[model samples]
Target chain A: MTERAVCVIGTGLIGGSLMRTAGKAGRTVWGTSDSPDTAEEARADGFDVTTDTDAALRRAAEDDALVVLAVPLPALPGVLRRVDAVAPTCRLTDTVSVKVAVADHVARYAPSARFVGGHPMAGTAESGWAAGQAGLFTGAAWVVAADDGLDLDVWADVAELAWACGARVVPAAADEHDLAVARVSHLPHLLAAVLAAVGAAGEDDLPLALAASSFADGTRVAGTRPELVLAMCEGNRDALLGAVDDALGRLGAMRGALASTGGLAATVNAGYAGRQRWAAARDPEAVRVRRSRLALPALREVGRRGDAVVGWTE
Target chain B: MTERAVCVIGTGLIGGSLMRTAGKAGRTVWGTSDSPDTAEEARADGFDVTTDTDAALRRAAEDDALVVLAVPLPALPGVLRRVDAVAPTCRLTDTVSVKVAVADHVARYAPSARFVGGHPMAGTAESGWAAGQAGLFTGAAWVVAADDGLDLDVWADVAELAWACGARVVPAAADEHDLAVARVSHLPHLLAAVLAAVGAAGEDDLPLALAASSFADGTRVAGTRPELVLAMCEGNRDALLGAVDDALGRLGAMRGALASTGGLAATVNAGYAGRQRWAAARDPEAVRVRRSRLALPALREVGRRGDAVVGWTE
Candidate 1:
């Protein structure tokens, strides 16, 4: 197989990691950052880096190459405009979490480029080039947006990049991507923030100190960057609003059940069943992989060596 | 310190752990389980165990020991009734999560005993004798509730037991304990279960597979025992209902703000600030202690070492 040339614009975590992974996969990789300092940092970290958008775009415009837009949502239009000027013939994709606005903008501004709105549903709270990891997208989902007149080979190349990075590609329309993320991602962040607010409202120091593993787990996403959350919510307002309403409606129904004479048991049973179904829906392999990666080697070894014990009664 | 003779009536996670911790602290500990198999297991595990409720209560009455009702909320009244029949003079306490209904029931049924409602805000998802750990309550919060006439020394003894298990005792009314837990614990579980339902509702397998650390963290509690969750919600119906309403109202307001023409940035900023403030409200030392205990030693060591370099800026 011929190796593809990959150009990643914006040398942040997503961009840098894509360049590194593609390079490791024997692809010719070039990357660009906003500033000279970041560009130098990326180069020092072994990425072929430039500060010039046109140079990066020109590199992507070459034969059998792909361009990745790994910048923030707000920066996408400008980046696409640059790509239009310098790499009009190149196949383009993105790593932005939100897709609706960016998809509309790309359709309007860079009609000539073979644009596929993509979101690798993976990341940490940490950002910047230094936080880049080669296996960051491994076993993650890369959503490829559905659009009209999209080239099959270009889509295949994009999907191949995701596969090479060990991500599972899921085909979706831009609106579906927006809605799914709003339900799973954005709404969780909002709920976490609200939980935090409630937790902080009281003056007692004991309750806060008494907050356990569940509290920590539930509020983890509340620590994410406010600006980014705001951007996603703003950029996909309709979808997020709908998801929020859906969640609240569910919560209201639960509350109503709790208030009724027999409602408490029914609500609790629903919650219990919901949890079981949720756990079943989760990928056991992914969970096992993550647990192995995060746990101490001793624990991992014990788990590996342990004999399986099963009770038939259950 | 006088070695208090304590009789723990239940061999589950809470009871077994309490027995071990109490034994470790040089207290004379005796435990009983409802099942013969559990009693045998507890005995084999080095706990003094019995299956005869009357014999266990007789022992408690003879020794004037503290009686810990560590059974489920639904089982509390029956357990108290049995205890009243055998050890009416003993100072009674419990480790139930929901307090209001249990307290009221005990007040009416076993009013002669100095019944102090207690909740040790600590546990793992695992239950029964094998799952018990000596350090289960370490760095946890123990909430104690009593009527006006309880002896101060008995209260102190209970507090001391909590302290010996490496927990900080927080005094609260039974009603207050119920309400507080409803907000912090019950509501979060409900939210997690509902969120999991939403994620499961999606047809594409990508979302579940692509779910990251954030998703896992948020949904951890949703995978716990549905029976226990249902019991808590059922037992503390009013409080849980109130908490659900509070949470939904806040979430609805946030959704409305995001949906409005005024833009989502301001609302999201407010949430961001709210989360930061919430995190700040926690006692750092307590958090560190708890995290160290739960996480692997290597991760704990990393946290310890990193504390010097990365002071929590937020």
Candidate 2:
């Protein structure tokens, strides 16, 4: 097989960060953005970015390079259709936060191409081309999955992409990925928004001046681009709704037991113990799979629980 | 007024930090703790601490000192009654997390001595004597108030105590302070606990592994001492319930608007705008009065918004 370069579509935060990371790794990288201004800004920031998606796809078709599908959920099916029509030989993966819906769409529409799903669990309240930094994924979880039969070599290439961005590749099933993020990411976004709205709910309520450190940190993600928050919350609506229900049920029980000081204290102490264990067990810096940033992986363990090796299974 | 020594009752996080800071400022200080082990820890950390409450009160009465009532809410009324019986000559201030309820209790129970209320907005998830640091209040707000009339000399001593710990004195009304903290501080605690409980609710629920940067920040305060959270929540139950109801209402609206992309986006955008305005307008570092940290205040402004000056009106 001829050498394939890395091609990234959609120069937003994840795509832009990958482009910069790949460029820094001395790989031939290309990127494209939806907005003309963003495309120009990416170009000015030393990226090979273009506004024309078709032209970029044609180039990738000629090169047979690996394509990174890093667009919003609503735009994914159409983008995959365009890619399948143009670059059938390209093995592709994505940075979509959810995996199941897109994996199903890819399996049906792009049956000729090898594609896996990925989500790098590092993001900030900032968005767009300007907000994307090369170091954004440093010590971040890059969750990857390929439910369909893809060549082991192609999966290795996707893992390489994660390493290029200073990320640790943790492979998991698509359903598992969706369920985990709904509780951890999506639920927190809506909760933050709820708290922010509560602060200003009434003219006489909660003067923002008294919003101390706890309040600021608690609602940090509510300040992210609203369009992105809405897209994400709506994209994983089912899992998010379930998580919300779980949280509401827990809160309802707390309300009932509030008068009993011992009961509330027990829950609070349990949470503290759980958090301490999480901090020790889930250190991102320790999640790497021993493959150096510049080297390819040996693909030893296809499925396991991210224990100093790539955690994935059939 | 005669030279007043600093006497901090309850050598916990706030009180311990104040004692350390006052010691650094070359002031003589005494501390009392409810727990024998905690008193031993404070003394080990170079504090003049004891477990005998009555002896500490007698010392404060003889020294003609400013007593800092830094006990938990459930213990505050009883502590104050002891003060009224034993040390009525001492001018007192408190570091209680909530203000209005304690102020009411003070008026009803200890009308003989002049008393002021205080709350230092700086806190961490960690608690107890070991968690205290001299720099805890270096750039924090020390909120003070007295619903009843206070002697200007005693109020100055209290303000001096705040500056000794490198905090800006921000005087606010007790009712206004409770309302503000109810929305910002208290509601966030319940929400954090609810989310933590939700994390481990169902058998197949969120793995703490997926609790990434956002989730961790959103629930940081949940890991704080449960007893402290219980006292603050129960002490300000009425205000907290109102804030929770407001938050639940906003969340209910979001749940309805989840089907409509534009509607959800608008609420998120409004929250972003509000947070931005808060960051710009509500900078704590810039909220200090022009009086030098070591100088006595001109008492320039007492009844305005908390925009770089004290916001208390007679």
Candidate 3:
């Protein structure tokens, strides 16, 4: 069937990005915001938007539009309940970070809507509609969760939507998605935060001043919005905890081995080899040929001056 | 006193870089190598080079040249003893990551030579003569250690050498420098290693494939030369252990709080704030102006036509 109008219920980063992508794809897009100021901002950005959620959902239902819930976790249930009251017959989807909770809530509150969970693995630490970009999800993995409560045909449509926005569709069970993300995303964020805190909480700012590219890269995620990060940590608490424990056990072993045998070469080598292999596998086309070095002219002129024989400029 | 010709007793990344910088500064530089092949490499790169240690030291002595011990930590003592036997009157310095050991070794093995410990805080995972660059030390902090046995005037000359190479000379006590780098450098390496190992040791490579910029950044140091990284960890063992413990305490508290209180916003916020302050303090001149986003023109025209509702050529 031809694509129908998409009602984006929240126009923050993810939703705004979806609307922008959909607009670029020549689809009719309607958006709503949590506040009048945001609604005004979205409208100013050329979106057909409003602060009236019930009216928007009812209009979406009347038009047989696809409704996308793209609000924060704490706000999802109320939105679902509102959707059930006004737009139950319309097919629905969501862009939430954690899937298991979203699946459960969708089942209980909007059972009449055929729903699948989506999580486009894109975006920066910055949020809000202001942070949105038309190409936000391009080249990213947009997870189309196959939650048992979700419908197969609807998921195909959801996957198609993801593809339309230039994302690779990754099908996964809700719990599996949550577990994978907790390990890949949440655990790293927590560790980075701790690392940054360690840098700041030191005897002084020496560590911070001495923090080069490596330290900055290692802790970049720690500088993200705390509220959003805390939400992910809370939502995937168990899996994140497991990942933390696993990493800590290995690191503690590395420290002990360093103290004793003067060897952690095995671990370091493994990591180096793994990253090389992973990079090769992920982008086979980008592998570079071996590079050559050194071919210059020779020179030597010797002289002596003082006890400090090497030249000093200042 | 006029600066004299210098002999560099290794031709790896750091040594080659120093030779290149000194060459650019119009000093006659002679470089030694572990083997003939490396000496050839240096010669091809336009360096006055030698493979014979005694021959190199004697040449340095005859010219009243300064000597830079640019070998690995394990190789330093032997080179220092060789300097004592052949060029004892020539003042000396070294480019080793750790400092206290270098200070002690200099005191014991090269008593007649004025010695100062140095560490140019620059470089990448790539090493050897092939990785050398003329401006490697530019904009970097080149630590000049104030070991009790080290001559103050020799250090001033050494600091001037660093300055002439376009570096900012940071004067510090040997132990203090060791402790600071332990907290900043070694600890980050350990964490990145463990983090990369965690990514590799997962159930599959999905985590690796999905590893984004954050994971890549956080684990970058893990991809550096395993042998060199191993040396840093082992050389700075005591200070590294202290940093590890301190970071673990904070991280464990974060994990525990995440598991129990359903509230870690405070800790996350603290870390976020810390990174911002650290970054601002680290590069105050580079602070960016705030940017605004989005005010696109509105448009919406929705309809459906089969799978073609969204145009797809694939």
Best by DockQ: 2
Model 3: per-residue Cα lDDT over A1-314, one tens digit each: 45778899898889989999989988888989998998898888898989999999998899887789998887888999999899886878888888888888887888888887888878787889889999998877676665444455566567667767887655566776676677667777877877777767755454565566667777889888887887767877777778888887886777677778867787678778766755653541211111121111100001000000111123
iRMSD, model 1, in Å = 7.2
Tens-place lDDT per residue, model 3, B140-172, is: 767666544456556556756776678765556
RMSD value for candidate 1: 10.0
Ranking by DockQ: 2, 1, 3
Computed on alpha carbons, the lDDT of every model, listed in order, comes to 0.71, 0.72, 0.72
lDDT of 1 by residue, A257-297 (tens): 66766354544455556556555654433212221122223
Pairwise DockQ winner, candidates 1 and 2 = 2
DockQ value for model 2: 0.40
User: Global CA lDDT of candidate 2, please?
Assistant: 0.72
Model 1, span B1-314: residue lDDT tens? 45678989998989999999989988899988999999998888778999998898898899888888898888887888887787776888889888789878887778788777778888876788898999998767777664455565566567667777777656665676677677677777888877766655555543454355666667778777777777776787777777777677777777767766726654455556656765675543422222112222322232222110111122
**Native interface contact recovery, model 2:** 0.42
- List candidate 3 segments past 4 Å from native: A284-314, B1-4, B284-314
Query: Over the stretch A71-181, how does candidate 2's per-residue lDDT look in tens digits?
Result: 988788888888888887678888888888778778777777777778888888878888788898877777777454556666667777777678777666677667778
